[model samples]
Target chain A: MRVLGIDPGLTRCGLGVVDGRPGRAGMVAVGVIRTPSDRDTGERLLYLEDNLTTWVRRFEPDVVAIERVFADVNVASVMTTAHATAIALLVAAKAGVPVAFHTPTEVKAAVTGDGRAGKAQVTQMVTSILKLTEQPRPADAADALALAICHTWRGGTEIRYAAAAARAGGPR
Target chain B: MRVLGIDPGLTRCGLGVVDGRPGRAGMVAVGVIRTPSDRDTGERLLYLEDNLTTWVRRFEPDVVAIERVFADVNVASVMTTAHATAIALLVAAKAGVPVAFHTPTEVKAAVTGDGRAGKAQVTQMVTSILKLTEQPRPADAADALALAICHTWRGGTEIRYAAAAARAGGPR
Candidate 1:
């Protein structure tokens, strides 16, 4: 299965696409969608939406995996991130792509075999797993790829709950 | 001038349109957009977007006025509302329409001459201002019309700040 993973944010939205089954996945693409904070908020959101729509159309992934957010000290920033995530979810649904969400811990555990793995450990595992000569630049890009890798390994089981629930219950 | 007012929510999004200035404004239209809780969150958002797009096209208001959200005990609900508001603002931006936000206190004060006005008093004032024989059914419908009226009366000065800020920088 092809999976498009997103680490959604207003200013820097991480994106990655992976193809193949668990443990045999190959990286298709990895990048981030950045919006200038100086622009209008509506324009920033529109930028994210328009570009994300372009990505989904171009990659045409079978599933979309988004990193789940719990809380943050900056409520304003969290709201923006939440709105970005909502836009991503809506885009996936409009394209009929199944959507799943994985918490930061779950992603770390799936990739590094430790729920509490720090950014360095996660980055190391992602580079080795993807067989990349160097770590992906700008942490967000690496995080997006890590999300895709995590989903490839653990998404099938988690999909039975998160994805299914979202498709049925309208976004809890 | 024409104004479109929005009281955004996940379950019921209230909308109304008015034309003319301050005390002479006349109601153009009013209604609510409802989304079933059973649908997926993505689908719900898509549904809202499509319907709202239709409303904006049909109304063709000069300015869009949306209720500003503050701290709510229900973070989840607030997030959904903020997302809805974001969608509205983005839609306005996409259409090149001016958009503004008004707090609940401002709306109440503009409509009833008191920031702490009770719901009934606001409803009464809205009925009188719109020259409606009876108050609009369902609190949301009335609230929407009140928002439209509030903008007509108080939006001019507010727009210099809110609308200008949004058009130049982004949604606030």
Candidate 2:
């Protein structure tokens, strides 16, 4: 299965694609879609939307996994993050890509065997999982890859297979 | 100038379109866009996006005004509201229409001369301002009209005009 994992943000949205199945996934691509912070909110959102659509078209992933943004006291930051996450969800739907969301804790637990795993530990696990010679550049990029790894081990293939069956003739 | 005001919500998004400026604005249309709460989040968002886009295309508003959602204790609710608001903003940007946001307090102050005006008061003031014989149907719809009135008085036309000139040759 090919999976695209998204770490949503306005200024820098991380995207990573992994190929293969559970316990044998390999990194296909890892990067971020960035927008200038100085841009208007609407314009920035449009940019992100455009790029996400482009990425989905280019990758043709079987499934899309996104890190869900939680409500928090830092309302301003959370709002922006929520907006970006919304864009991601909207993009996936438009592209006819079935998408699922994993919480930060869920992702950490799946990737590093600890719900409270630190960033370094998570990144290290991601590197080991993908057997990459070096860590994915930038923390966000590594985090995106980790999300892909987590999804694979945590039922992404089953979800995609189920979605495919639904599309074919089974109950949704 | 024509203005479309949006009060964003996942289940009940309020939309109002008005004609004319500041002291002379009148309602052209007002209604609520609702989606079943039981629908999946992506489907609900898609419904709001489709309705908002349809409204803008039909009305061809000169500007779009949306309530600026703030961070609150209800994180889940706020995030959903923010997502709907993002869809509104993105639709306006895509249509090449300038968009403005009025805070709840700002909308109340502009409509009723009191920032802390209650919903009924704001609705009453909106009815008075729009010279409507009766209050706009639902409270959400009334709040949307109030946002339109606030935008008209608060220089939506001036902002649009300035944006036009900037696109023509003036500084942005």
The alpha-carbon RMSD values of the candidates against the true structure, listed in the order shown, are: 5.8, 4.3
lDDT by residue (B1-172, candidate 1, tens digit) is 8999899887999988989675677888988999878988888888888888899999999989898886444777877887788778778878878787888999999998899998888888888888988787677777788888888888666556787888899775
Q: What shift in Å separates residue A23 of candidate 2 from its native position after superposition?
A: 1.7
Q: Which segments of model 1 are wrong by more than 4 Å? A: A158-172, B158-172
Of the candidates shown, which would achieve the greatest TM-score relative to the real structure?
A: 2
Provide the TM-score for each candidate, comma-separated. Answer: 0.87, 0.90
How much is B56 displaced in model 2, in angstroms? 1.3
Q: Tell me candidate 2's fraction of native contacts, as a decimal between 0 and 1.
A: 0.60
